[model samples]
Target: MSSILRRIFKGKDQQHQIVIIGLDSAGKTTIVNRLLRSEFIPTTRTLGVNYRTVKYRQIMFSLIDLGGQEIYRNLLWQPSLEKADAIVFVLDSADLRISEASKAFWESIQQNENAPVLFIANKIDLPGARTFDTIVQDLDLTRATRSSRPVGLFRISAKTGENFYDAFDWLADVVVGSESVFKCKLRTVILIDLDSHKIWTTKFSSLKNEILDEFNRSISETMHELMKEPAGMEVIIASDLQLVVVKNHPLVVGLIIGYSDSVVRSKLIAERLMNTASSSIEIGEFSSDVLTKLLKRQWPLDIYKSKPRSD
Candidate 1:
């Protein structure tokens, strides 16, 4: 009975309705505040629906935050879901009422089948926060999967801003019909010298040693090829793995990223890492500990400085 009007404006700019829903005290409003202001803003329980239009990466998101209380949810959830281009379900990662939240989530999405879903386990910075795997199991998301719709599950802390942009980046990509550029996960980082000899390398996520060795060899080969030119950057995809080789004169930094898609987002991340490396360490003079410190500094979440972990 209800329909969402997706509007297209100028070049590469469009508007989509995004409905944010969850149980009370699930940090829905806080997430919206972070998106709108890009800062931590505390908010109270929503009594009704709050609407705002936010532009992110040239896309206007008509964010409709529906009140999560039982009364308001019974009264307003259907209409909001009916008109949503994407549905964001926020869950309190530390909350004990996950069953209640799960029931509410399933009930809310029953009527909507086409809208993409982004499941965010919020408050990951808090103590006793559930891990991403645990939360996914708790929500029964694995069993109640929607193959027709694209679904993204991410663990994030809106307070500390950890993995915040990564989640939104996926949402933005999916909403715009661009598959997923941000899904490229940082797997391994290799710092090579002008002679193509490895100065230092580290793997983030767990991988088989053989696979890691293969990736290293591929990266080394690519590094050698790039060292021939001694300038510019190149991205190489080996099946699912992505290698971003940057030649900065005396140093060539190779980043092995998982889930090879495109070169744009991964290259930007690699370039930023290069910038950090350039400022933090001198070429051919830093120890592995120093490089490790640099990486931990650059991506606190990836290395996991605290208790929260993103998957």
Candidate 2:
């Protein structure tokens, strides 16, 4: 099916809304950029909220990027809360003061009582950032546990694109079928589902051969083969395996591999892939468990079900 026809038939029933709120410069924009694998430069603070649509699996999401500054913080309540399927609160782990702010934000968000919240301790790459345990304790979030509404806390570095996928995968599970709230349009992009036995790329085109050849020579022969044929011309290498591609854009593809091999093997592959493509390559890591869930299209409801917030 053509991307256009798929949309025409699927209609708006296939979308959902996810809101990302945090203090100013808490790496909210960085998280979005990492997800899109593109840069979103913000010269000034977010005036109200910025919206972007991302497609994961066969589902599409209308992601609302809300400003975290004090002046704009109040705008995130009520009306916005009414439509949110999930909320991601990004925090600056390097700043102790931000921990207190995160507590306050959580308290405020708790009052809404409708949407689930994911606490993202962002900027883990900073030198002085507190560890995940420290941030959870400092924010007093351990005491704020709930048994009904699922609250998730993750430590991540948006700058280096670490743990961003884990966080999004959680949100994806929560809002999967409930994503119909988003009525916006989306562009044609392929979503790769990484699996243990094979790599699955979904879209409406025949780019699987291209992706397979690209994956084999640079990475592991263990990578085997591409499972499904490409739906669209777009191919996103989604796997827990490490992918080394020359340049950020898909057009500069060379080799994609896993990061688990011996140091010598990994370095040699990286060097070869880089030299072949002659462009900057990016290495992406995925949690094997998350990749499994993505392939099965199953929600990790167990993770969310354990802790519900108390009144």
* C-alpha TM-score for every candidate: 0.60, 0.56
RMSD of each: 15.0, 14.1
User: Model 1 over residues 60-94: C-alpha lDDT tens digits?
Assistant: 79999999888998889998898889999999999
lDDT of each: 0.74, 0.53
**What is the Å distance of residue 100 in model 2 from its true position?**
4.4
lDDT of 2 by residue, 145-213 (tens): 553777878887776545555566566656653542221111111122332222323222233455545
Give the Å error, residue 219, model 1: 32
Clashing pairs in 1: none
